[model samples]
Target chain A: MDVRRRNNVVVTGPEDGPVLVLAHGFGCDQNMWRLVLPALARRHRVVLFDYVGSGRSEPTAWSEERYSSLAGYAQDVVDVCEELDLRDVAFVGHSVSAMVGVLAAQAAPERFGALVMVAPSPCYIDSDGYRGGFSAEDIDELLASLESNYLGWSAAMAPVIMGNPDRPELGEELTGSFCATDPEMARIFARTTFLSDSRGDLDGVSVPTLVLECAHDAIAPREVGAYVHDRIPGSVLVTLEATGHCPQLSAPQATAAAILRFLEHPR
Target chain B: MCRTEEDPEPREPDGAKDGDRTTDAAFSALLEDSVEELYESAPCGYLSTLMDGTIAKINSTLLEWLGTDRETVVARKRFADLLTVGGRLYHETHFAPLLRMQGRITGVALEMRTGDGGRLPVLVSSVVKHSGDGEPLLIRTTVFDASARRSYEQELLRRQREAEEARRQAEEARRQAEADRARLTEALAALQRSLLPAELPVVPGLETAVHYHTASPDRLGGDFYDLFPLDGKRWAFFLGDVSGKGPRAAAVTSLTRYTLRTAALHDADPAGALGTLNTVLHERYTGDDPRYCTAIFGVLEPDRDTGEVTVRLASGGHPPALVTRADGTAHFLPTPGGLLVGVLPDPHFVTATTVLAPGDTLLLYTDGLTEARTGPDRTDLYGDEALHAFATRLAGPPPGGLVQALTALLDSLGDGVDDDTALLALGVPARPGAM
Candidate 1:
């Protein structure tokens, strides 16, 4: 497996600068970091890649068994880091990718320098005492919506789904402006991402970490964010003024500033 | 303007003036009251949110459905805050991002948390309103009750799951039926084997070998053969086939086998033994379920002085025997006109006498050998001519070798051999020190 081809790796900035790897969440690909890239790319060597089943990555790399859990996604991240031979890397993850990055860092702690989890939740379902924001029933409804909406997306994305390399026009039709994704891939990825329980993985993190929680985030509520911060030892928790789930897109300046502040101050 | 002069002013009628006054008052009432009435009590809920999902304005009807007043919902709670915990997660992840990217989204299903803590299933549509300078201003949203649609969707999901479960169970049943049939076939196979001799009685001077081939795995075949000693000097051997297959044919096969052995005890002649078997079968099955058999019974008498075997074989509608001589030559010992045994009480049974000296072999078999199918489609038969041709090539092999070679040929025929077959070979070993 060619890691760069599978993840659609894009590397920029000074090669000598400290590496910054950005992993996007479930909905979109690396395009989610477009707003923050401009501000952060100047000072550090920025690295970005799409998960195997998402965005411009090789579509054929998806295997139902391998991708049934988030471990497969973390393996892809580790592959990219290993392929580039980057060490002590600063990793930024948004949404579900935050847990994905955590797993990757845990597998290879020497390669990861620090972790910045943006609006991350270790789990999405509510347990005995934990308030992870959503219920198991809610997740089912979300899966139902995915299936219902996929009827249209599948028709339009059939060509791309078959991985036809000869017809560039059909591929263009699939990867049009927004977060264009294969419907089946999106559905499976959505299930894998939300249904995962990584609360047990938080304590094993050895890297310096920052948990960036936004005000009134629906996907990861204030309590969920705080829960993640409390679980990880010696980790800093920063509450941003930015609202909603995606501050990277909505308030990129504030998001980037918080990240830069964390990077500048080692302690 | 100066000519505004009032020359020729007409007088107004009292009835017309009253009508004009009534129409003017009705138009004024429509303009004044309907606007507020339509905004407050419309069928669907209406609300406007700023870019951050904050609820800026909400109508009375929406407020009433949410069971909350305008002030509590207005600036204090965001539109997303009015949603249930699950709905908020969905709104934040998919709904809001889609609205931001597409500028408008329609028919999005979500549940709003009412003030009474009950959930309201609603279908929402929102459009991002823009300022005149093309800057993003506010998001205007409309909500409709989707309670009925929700219940219908739930019912559909339940039915789909039930259908999948039914299909899974049906597949399991089919597999079970196949397993049961296999077990029954195995039992029938064991029963069929019980009708034949487990081991041949050793003749002092003759080498004997036999093979039985069953065409199907799941049903009992009709072919059976046995070799047993008649006395100290003579041996009785018979190879026969009943008419059909399965349990009924199996019954007839067992009856014929025992009748042959008993008849041979009383008479040393092959023809006399077959006569007894024919009468037994003809008497037992005289009704609608008539059963019949084709058989060849032979008596082998070894001469100790000459080192030769005298074989008298009586054929009853069976294929002729093949004799391979000492000089490596083969020919059919034709018993031309013998009628099938068990079909009639007095069937013609013919005896073909042959001598098996040193290096001579006599092979007896049922018609299953010659009448076996030759091709995959079974369109061609391994007729008497083909068997004759194949036997001539096997002139040098002894009894055991002949049986083994023919079994290999049967295996190569694959699906072509659709009937059960039984073979019995008797070879006289070459005289010691003859070379």
Candidate 2:
């Protein structure tokens, strides 16, 4: 009851290096950032924390509006920056978190130095000019599938999102991870994430952006990565050799190397 | 026609019968076969035509129906000759060409000459049989007694008219229902209007735009948003959706709205105000039909000098706000951990504070935008990511553009939007140089 909700963040890396905040996206929390943490933390002041809804983060705080979009998650970046008084913080977000960072940086421009968006999708529905990869029918079918069997869908959706549905363990682990979390919250979150449209804000990001495109990411396809790259002005796009959505989980070295490379050279 | 007489068994005929017994058997067989014979008494017309419309045969059925003899219809006349003058003309124009192209025409009604000099109705169907060499051959024709079929058709027509009348009535009823639904929606929209601020007060330093899109107009929706003065220098706004529908959910929403405003009035504390609303909802709708809502309650303090407005937001079940800059960039203000308004006693609400600089706009809306049903390829659930992306494009426009775009969006949804939506936007106007 006395939880002030302030001290939950964990920071590592060089004591006086530039602040670099790494945000994990929709399903998993800060733990998902483990792979790239050591590599980034060694050179910069690495900031990591669970979003109020996932990982070790508090679950009771999630709301329909607050967590309805990645923007809230993006604000977490700015909030963390302000709380820690981060200056020129380099933000590296994975999946949706990357998108969240892009918006957050746009909101509080001074707080952000550069953004690295890995395997990001701005919109899931195709418009006249853009192919959002799914049709209205496809999304409805997906929603129906999720509605019918949430747990099964979560397990099934994770690997698909990660672009590694073939691995049985991937499904098992995702289901296990998603199931251990609050199903109701997870359900709403799932609906919110998949139904989001962030294509509008891609151009608004003024800071230098590096969009990391995963070659075989199921959720954020290469085309989507390119889309993000196109909307962002002077945004550098890097295609990773790795496959899968959570490259940090599946292929950390490649993911880390990509982030490091982007940080070293800013557009 | 003459009937063949049958011989009764002769008393001696039985004993004197020939070994074949042919006498009685032949007479009886002949008499019995005559009974089974269909005497095609010319009740209605029957006739046949040659390949060139020449009358080849005619039956008593037609002759009696027409009150005429076979002499008038046989080779002495072509089949068309039996038709009335008007019918013969029709036979040459529309009917003949259709039959030629189709190779068969059936059930054609034509008038025939009666011996009494009266006309009778008849229906004819014809089939043309050709030789193997593709030479035009004879046309076999069948005539039907069409008086009953004509009556039956009339009866069908009458029934169809009645059915059509009934359908029109049903359609009228449906139209009435739609009108009622529209009225209810209009009333509901009116009621919903009373929940939010009619128009946002012009924040001196900001370019503010708010847009709301509810998926449908027929049903009362759950989304609500408002921006009002909290104190002299500060403003409070919150966008949220209440759970459930009807009066119960409306009550929850009303309570949440009032609580946020009053709580903010008391403390102007973003987190504290939302927490107050959450506690009130939990206590009031505590049992049975538990109610909860997601709200993003914000406290915007405009800084006159830098033309920056710092937005302190505490979310309890609401979507994040999109901040659009004058440079035409849009992004969501992150407010991560916020409980749905009514569930927990001490539900967690995450507050992430950020400043929207001059020429930057912040947009807050309910989940209805993201959850809108549209898309050519997918269920167009315009979720958070898409909204942010949408706002991202509106970055360079004035705040009013956001409202305009959203209004248009909500309008497009028509009846698909089952939920009510609320939108509130705050923007720091672009400096003259920036624009």
Candidate 3:
């Protein structure tokens, strides 16, 4: 399949502007960038695409082998860049996609210029000398909660989680509706997102990176933000006063401002 | 009706003023006593926190549950300080942000730490109290005992684990059954191999080859063949097919083989040996369950002076033998009008005599050879016509070459051979001057 159709890529803004690719995280599709896109697209060319099995992307492309690791997802990003002939692209990733962006930048350094990780964590579970702010048991509980609460009536619940303005048409066409993903796909993605360990990949990133951590974020705590910043060489750490895991939805202006400020300064 | 400042007490008289004063006093007393009692003795715990999580006010019920007094909780401890370490982390990350975005959170499960460092599982629900203009003023929270609910969830988790373990054990049992079946197949294969000769004996001035094909490994097929020297000059060989398979058929095959060898040693004639076998089988199986077989027995005598091998073969309800000439022409040496070997009391076995001259080959085989299906739908057999054509394609090669060609033909008929086949080829190699 053509990469644009497979990933459901949507590009908008001025024709000659700098490219900014926005990747949504585990729960939502590209619609997670709905709040930040207006401000972001004003200055730069904004690109939004869904991962396979999410949003308007082709679910048929999903396979257990292709999505067994984050590297496969990084390849999707690179494929999109190659298809569009985009070079030195700015990448904005939320939650798990933050690490996916890191992997993509490492895989094809020429394709990426800057990396922005929102509420990112190198690891989710606590290890020796590391504070990821979650226990294995807590993640299990979260999975159980997702199974019990989401799968039963996912189509109706997705719009609420996406929380976009009244675009019911967009909601109807999504694969299984819940965060624009099949319930089974969401469960697998959740496990892959929460159980991954991308700590070793941090040191290999040569691009300018910004680590955005929200205050009072339960998923990725302040210490995790600090840890990621320290591992990624020459990466800038910015703490948002917005109090949630999804600052783009809760406080769009501040979230966009932090990203814009980071892009303006080189180091 | 307007009352000026001078007449501000126009409506109040001395009797009314006294009555109002007593009612007001009683109402104030009730309000003062009940408010403190309700706040201190509510069924659930109550607490209020500033935006920064510092506890501003706490009720006696909450303080008692935490094993801490009012002095320690109020203004000294933040609301997160009363929670367990993991719960505190959850509160700071997930709960606090959720509350800020949603303006309220309910039914959050957490554990609170007591003064003596014991934990109490509780369900917490909190809301941000807002001023008139929708500004969040303070955090108000309520805690409910969740020990019973926690135990119920634990029970469910245990049952789920038990079910998973049961499924795993069942899968293991299935795997074990498969392994056992594989072992049984191996044992059957060994038994089948034991029924065949370890190696064929070498004959003077003759080239010979034999092949036996089994339809399945689950049960032994009832096809047998043997080639042995009767004396110094003559060799006896037989190929046979029993009517059925498995242990009973295997027993009959063993009996038939020994009877043919013994009878051939004494009789020296191919037809006479088959006659002896028929008589013995008819006598042994006169009971209710009848058993039968089709067989071809042969005597090979090589002529050293003329470089020719004379083959005498007897057929009892078996396919005719094929003699492919030195010139690559093939035809059946027909032995018709013979009865099944083990059925009739006085079965007549017919003998066919042919010479396996230099470069000539004689093929003695069971009907399973010509009866193998060859069509795509498997409705048609590799009949006499096809075998004739196949032998012709061999170009009258020596015994080994013919056997190899037949083996390739059998290999090409995969999933089509429904019965066992035994073939014996005897040929006198072409003389250097004869070619």
Candidate 4:
């Protein structure tokens, strides 16, 4: 299989620069990195891709059994790395992808050098003494929300959203197709993302890691960010002055600066 | 109403008439109902929010529908705050992003929480209002009640699910029926084998071959054949077709085969064996659905000195047997004026005798072969004359070769041979050293 076409891998930067693979989280595709790409690509080689069943990636490659767990997504990361034959690469992950990076680093430890987790949460549901910011019922509510929006994301509503005349700044190619995914595939992804518990895997991170969290995120609260930082030994935690679960879109400069600073000086 | 005649005197150039006064009063009344009244009591709900989705202003119609006052909602709640948890997630993930990119979105379905804790289904349309320099300033939205429409859509979805389930059940039933038919065909094949000989017995100095063809797998054929030794120097054989098809005819065929074998062991004469079978069948099936069969029973005796076989056969309304000569000639060994077996109290059985010389074959068959339809229209019967001609064409072949040729002929007839057929051949080898 051509893994590049299957994952929609896009590589952009100086030819001889150090490699930085940017992975997007749930609910969106690699286009989530649009705001931070310009700054990060200046001196570092940046790689971007949509996981199977998301964005422009081929939908035919998606299977419910493979993608129902975080391990399958990590395999996608390992596949892209092996396909390009890259070594000592920096892996940047957002939301649920941050945990996916943790898994990929463990599976192929020699391929990845450093890890950058933005708005990362190892678990989303609260249990024991840990506050993951959501109850089990909230995840079920989120799945229900995904089903309700299925009609809106169906083919019937796609044309109206694609033919926007007012905001030409939002390019024609990226407007309607930005976050539109197959509804059934999105349901499986939502269940996988919101129901996962990767807290135990955080302790095994052997490489230099940067944990970037937003100031006020309802999805991944500050305590969940602290839990991730405390679990991984010698990891640096920086709280960006942004709201919501997506700091890259809400505060791109701070997000990129923190990542670049960690690459220059790992302490 | 008569003012025109009453005021017949010369009027002033500038004058106020009664019609003009009434029109002025009506216009003043229309102007009194102001824009604020129209906005507050419109048919649909309306609201305006800031660029960040904070509710800035809302009309009375929407406030009443939400069952809240301006003081509690005007600046305190954002548009996302008014929605249910599921709807809020949808707004953040798909709706808000599309609205930000598209500048305007219409007829998006969502559910809102009412003041009484019930859910209100609504359709919303939002447009981003832009400033003179084209920077987005605020958002204007309209909401329409969609309870009836949502209920209708739910009904459609329910029916669609039901139809899919019904179709799935139908497919499962069809698959089950096909499996049952296949198992029945296998059982019928096994039963049919039980009525015939597993393999024909070898008679010293005589070559024998046989073939049976069935037209349908679902229906068991009424044809049977068997060959067995009667004594030290004699072998007896029989080939027959019962009157009908399937289990009823199959039962009669089974009875006839066993009776012929038992009777041949008791009395070695060809006529005596068939006479016993007719008596047993007539006594066993004496009702309205009387069963009968056409059969040729025969005994073979090989002459040690001449290396030839003498065949004595008795026919009960069966087709005459054919003998193909070594010198490329063929003729039927006739057993004339015989009646069908088990049809009368005492059926007359005619006996015929023929000898197979070196390199000559004697063939016995049921009438299914001669009764087979042929020609372009398939209305013509392949009669005794045609069989004689066909046998004459291949007169010099051995018993196995002759039976093989006839099997191929039956196969070529295909669907035209609608009945079951059975053929048996006996021949003597021309060269004693070759045998």
Candidate 5:
């Protein structure tokens, strides 16, 4: 399998520079990193990729059995790393992909060095005095949300949105196309991301990790970030002065600066 | 009201100026009242949220629909707060991202939670308001009540689901019907095999072969043939077709086959065995649906000193037996005026005797062969003359080879031969020294 084509792997920046693999989470694809790509690429060889079922990745490569769990997504990460034959690389993952990075680093420890988690929650459902910021019913509600928005993500509307007649160049842009994935694949990814519990896996982290969270995020609260920080042996936590789950798009400079600072000085 | 003066160009039109001033005053009052009323009481709801989705301004119509006061909604609740949990998730995941990327999104369906805890389905369109320097400022959104349209869409979806389920059930039923037909055909074929001999017994100094062809698998064939030993020296062989097809005729054929074998073992005379069969069938079936059949029962007696088999066969309403000579000539031995068995109280069967000399073969068959249609129009019958000619051309081979060639001829007839056919051949081998 050509992992590069299967995952839609995009490589930018200097060849000899340190590698930073950026993985997007459940909703959008690698295009989510567009706002922060320039600043990080100046000093690092940044690698961006869409998971098998999302973005511009090959749709034929997606299978419900493989992508219904985070391990299947971790295989995609491991495949990209092995395809490029990179070593001691920094992996930056957003939202649900942060736990995916955990699984990949454990599966192939030699390929990954440091971990960067952006606004991630190991478990979205709150349980056993642990506040993951949602209930089991809420996750089901999110699935229902995906069902209600079926028309929004339909393939019929994709061409109309991508082919904006007033600005023909925008038709070629990847902005509107990033979030238009196959709805069935998106539903599986949603169920997998919201139902996953990776807090126990954090204790096995042997690499330097950065936990980046939004100061006022509705998805991942501050307590979840502190809990992740406390679980890892020597992990560092930084709160970006941003809102929402995506700090890369909401506050790109702070997100990029904090990442660059962590890359230059790990300790 | 102003009226035109009859005296043209004389009056200063004082009355007209006074009337115009009064009308202008009333129109100004009406415009002032409509400006705010249109914004507050429009048919659709409208709102404008700040960049982070804080409701900065809302019209009175939207507030009324949400069942909330201006103080509670304006600058207090975000746009997502008014929507149901599912709708909020849709807003954050798909609607917001698309709106941020494209600057505008339209006709998105969502459900808002009213103050009374009821749901109001609505379609929303939003556009971002940009500053002069192209910096992001706030969002302007319009909401329209879509209760009627939502119910109609629900109906369409329900109908679509019903259609899919019906199609799936139809496919399942068709598969079940096919499986039932296959099982029935298999059972019928098994039953049909039970009526025929598993294998022909090997007779001393005699080479024998037989073939049975069935027109349809769904219906059991009425044709049957068997060859078995009668005593230490002589052997009995019979080939016949019942009066009709299917299980009823098959029952009669089964009776006919067993009665002849039993009667032959009792009395080895060819005419005597057929007489017993005719009596048994006539006694068993004597009603409105009287069962009858056409048959040929023969006994083969071989001479140990010379390669000669003496054949004595009796035909009852059956075609005449064919004898292919060693001299490459074939002729039918006529058994004239043989009455159909089980038709009369004492149906007389005609007996024919022939000597199977070296390199000579005797063939017995049912009428399916002679009655088969031939020619381009399929209106002509392949009569006894045609079979005689065909048998003459295929005279050199032994009984097995002759049966094989005749089976191929039957296959070439294809759909022209619609009835089931049975063929049995008995031949004596030529002496090795003789030409």
Candidate 6:
């Protein structure tokens, strides 16, 4: 059967090796992993894809029924891995994808060997005694914010995650991240992220997992990371000294080192 | 007449000098009497209180306002006692301590108790008189009769409250308008949702998912999407954003949605389908308040045996589609330079074609995605490159899973996307032994 590659540059490594699929977070694609992925690809088969409604994914291929929940996305990982006949999967999901892996693993636990959730959040809004740290009102305000001004909120929030980019700020820096997903997709994604009760998904993440909590992450604070660690029993929790939501981007060397060590030792 | 220095000093006659001296003394006495009388007989009253709030002295003006006897009040009863029931309690609870600490309390309005038990409202200004050594002495107070002033203030307050009530009514009216708009938006959303399949109708050899989020109900966003039957062999679908937002925006969206269907029914030309919708909007809103849209209309014809979808798209000011392959590679299938719908009497839309091979997913969306905000350092909008990376991850998911992930991705954006957005994805299951 003849299959076509959909993107610009395709990297081919070993035919039969452990699969390391890299999933990006909000406002970024697989390219973000370019700095570290080359190292991982040397030993393992690397697979990467853009999320639907973003990157190179076909817009017509996106459906509310299919893309309404992140679990659907998790299934996509399994589908991609199955397509490659890959096993003992090491899926590294950043930010949102970090939790997406959990939901996917719950759907097909037999397929996944381990997960490295980088700067993850199962639930952003805190509950009573729960350290999501954000109040229900906070989430409501967030939703209100998105509803009122999609571009404006994006301009404000995207920086918090992509703070201190590798380079200097251009005048248009504030408006940059928002240009990725269509504003409409953003509304759907915002409602899903802020409104989702993913704590339930946390309990189901049973694989040997490493939850890397960023030190100064404004979005996923220390407390929520602790909660994620506590819920996934036997899951080792490590607070990465690196500060910011995208430690892999802000502090790549440290992030890569941590992931390499964790992958080798089953932390 | 010049008088030399030696001239006799000016002198008045005895009768004149006597009269001038008597006149000056009488004028000074008169001025003093009137000035003293003004303070004594002013409209308000003045008094002094001991540090303990014992009334030390009182003037006739105070007595008149209170309708009380100075003999019975001053040096006998405490100042707090001179207040009516509520005023006395208030004095003890709120006023007394504030005056003691601050050394002054002014403009405190209270009703004084008359001997007949009537209450007369008065504005009181009090100061804690201190000695040379800074030791607190008597409290000197001035009282102004505020009956007329209070009535005037009350009338003004009443008018203000009435105006506030009117303002609230206006707000309620505006809120109702918003609610009505929301209801209309809800109805439109419901109809729009129904127009698309609850699940993308499964054509053999294809896994499909689509997501559509209207920006808000405050204004009916001009975004609309649909997935329907073109024929037994193919499916018809389109997602679009009307140029404006509101009823007019929704109108154009509905027209686009319906016309695309009708055009596809007539003949499955994605370009012709969009062209018809464009024509309709052009004709309807050709007036000064012009409306336009950007749309991506496509037909998914699957080769069941090979498991491939030959996708043909017609774009009207829409972003290009993204194609992510089974092997984790992705790029945008550029469909650029399409004129906006209703941009001209006869606008020309563009068409692009791609084949969705097995183990691949295709993403279609309005510009809302790329225009999404990414803050901080990458302070530009979410661009095509980032999305390409996103699609490369999900190149292998089923439709349901794809929508879920896309929905989550959208959710992560929060307010980054301030526009209504729509997403459509199609990917094929892995054939055994492909890896």
Q: What is the interface RMSD of each candidate, in Å?
A: 7.0, 32.2, 6.4, 2.8, 2.8, 24.5
Q: Which one wins by DockQ: 1 or 6?
A: 1
How well does candidate 3 match the true structure in TM-score terms?
A: 0.58
Q: Write the per-residue lDDT of candidate 2 for residues B332-379, one digit (tens) a residue.
A: 667666678778898888887888876777777776666766765336
Off by over 4 Å in 6: A1-267, B1-199, B217-219, B345-348, B376-379, B393-395, B432-435
Give the residue spans of candidate 5 off by over 4 A: A152-160, A163-176, A196-206, A265-267, B1-41, B175-212, B217-220, B226-238, B246-305, B310-318, B333-354, B374-380, B389-414, B429-435
| lDDT (Cα, 0-100) at B17 in candidate 6 | 51
TM-score of chain A of each: 0.91, 0.82, 0.92, 0.96, 0.94, 0.80
Writing each residue's lDDT as its tens digit, candidate 4 over A96-121 gives 99999999999999999999999899
lDDT of 4 by residue, B1-435 (tens): 111121223332344456687766665665564556656766778888986677998888788888888988888888877887667666655566556656777777788888888878788878888887877788888888888977776676568669989999999999999999889888887988878998987788888899888765655779888989988888898888889988889889989999999999999788888899999999999898899998999998989998888889999888898999888899999998877888888888999998888899989888779888886555798899999999989866789999999889988887768888999988997784543
lDDT (tens digit, per residue) of candidate 3 on A9-86: 999988798899999877667867766788999989988898987767888998877776888888889999999999
Candidate with more favorable, higher TM-score: 1 or 3: 1
lDDT for residue A216 in candidate 1, whole number 0-100: 66
Residue-by-residue lDDT tens digits, candidate 5, A1-267? 689999989999999999999999877788778779999999799999999989889999999999989999999999999999989989999989999999999999999999999987888889998999888887787786575556444543465476543323345766456567887899999999989999888888889999999887777889999998999889989999876678887688999999999988886
Fnat, model 6, is: 0.00
RMSD for each of the candidates: 10.3, 37.4, 12.5, 8.3, 7.6, 31.8
TM-score to true structure, per model? 0.69, 0.35, 0.58, 0.80, 0.80, 0.37
> How much of the true A–B contact set does each candidate keep?
0.20, 0.00, 0.04, 0.31, 0.23, 0.00
lDDT of 3 by residue, B310-408 (tens): 888888988898999899999999989888987988878888889888999988777667888888655798989999998998888889989888888
Better of 2 and 4 by DockQ: 4
In candidate 4, position A130 carries an lDDT of 89
**Candidate 1 lDDT, A164-219, residue by residue in tens:** 33222224433453465776788789899889999999999888899998986878
lDDT tens per residue, model 6, B231-321? 7888887887888676666666777777788899997998888778778878888768788888888888889777778888888888888
Query: How well does model 6 score by local distance difference test?
Result: 0.69
